[model samples]
Target: MNTFPIIETERLILREATCKDADDMYSYLSDKEVVKHMGLEPYQTSTDVLEEINWYQSIRKEGTGIRWGITLKGKDVVIGSCGFLNMQPRHYRTEIGFELSKLYWGKGIAKEALNAVMSYGYKHFELERIEALIEPLNSASQRLVEKQGFTKEGILRHYEYTCGKFDDLYMYSMLKAEFELG
Candidate 1:
C-alpha cells in the first residue's frame, strides 16, 4: 500500500485517513454548509463517513492518488481534506481539490496544505501539471489557488453539476516548471 507519512507544517499535520477518523470526517462531511460548494452529497451519518474512509484506504493499495485529512497541531480533530483526483498518469497530471471546515476558513491552512501536496506531486510523483476546477461562485477557493501560483486557464461553461444544478467553473493550472521557478 502507498504509505502517507505524516507531513508537518507550522500548524498542521497532513496525514493518512484512518477508520478512526470517521467522526472527524463526519463532522465536516455531514454539514450542509461545508459541502455546499463541494460537488458531492453531504454525508448523512458516521456510517457513511466510515464507508468513504474505507474507500480512501483501498485507494492506497493501488498506489494512486488519495486524500489526506488535515489535522491541526496539538489537536486530534481534522479540519479539512486535500488531495488529487482524476489522476492521469499518461498525461502526467491530476486535478487537485480541497475542503476545510468552516471554522478554519480564511486561516491560510488550505493554501499551506495545497502547496505541500503540489510539492509532493512534483517531487515524488513526477507530475507535470496540477489543475484545480473551481465553481465560479467560490471566490475564496479561486483566490486560494491563484495565490498558490495556479494560473487561470479559462472558464469552462457548465463544467460540472454542483448543488443540484449545472455550474460554470474556472480552470486553474500550475506546471512543474513554473512551480520550480517560483
Candidate 2:
C-alpha cells in the first residue's frame, strides 16, 4: 500500500519501523543466533540497521512489499520484524518472513503477529498464495508455518545464493483456500 499498515494483535503491535527503532532492531538483528537462518549477516552497525529499515520502506513505496516493526502492546521498543517480500501481485503471490529477538525466544509473540499479518495479506491483496522459503535448518520456522496451515511443497536444493554460498530452502505454501486465521 502507499501507506504502511499497522497491525495489532492480542499483545503486540506490528507497525512501521522508523529511525527510532534502529537501536532496538540492531540489538536483536546483530545477534548471530537471531540472523543465522535469516539469510542475512548479523548487522555490524546502527547504520546497517537503518539501511535495512530503509529497504523496508523502499519496498513498500515501490509497491513490491511491506515490513513491520514488532513490539509489545504496551511497549515502544521494536523486538522483531515480519513481512512480505519479493511481491508478485500480478501473480497473486508474495514471500513471507520473520525474525525475533533472542531475548523473546520461546514466547508465542511471533506466531501471534504472524497470524495477524497473514490474515491481512490474504484479504488485503486477494492473494491466491503466500510462500515461505525457509532454511532447511530452521526447525522453529518449519513448525510455525505448518501449524498455520502451510504445506511443504518440497526442498529447493541450493535455490538461493546468499551470504557467499548456495543454500537449500524448504518451500512451504498456503493457498487461498487453505488459509484460515489461527
Specify the highest-TM-score model's number: 2
Mark the 10 consecutive residues where model 1 has the least summed lDDT. Answer: 56-65
Tell me how candidate 1 scores on lDDT: 0.85
TM-score of each: 0.91, 0.96
lDDT of 1 by residue, 133-163 (tens): 9887788999898888899989999988766
Q: Which parts of model 1 are misplaced by more than 4 Å?
A: none
- Candidate 2, poorest ten consecutive residues by summed lDDT: 1-10
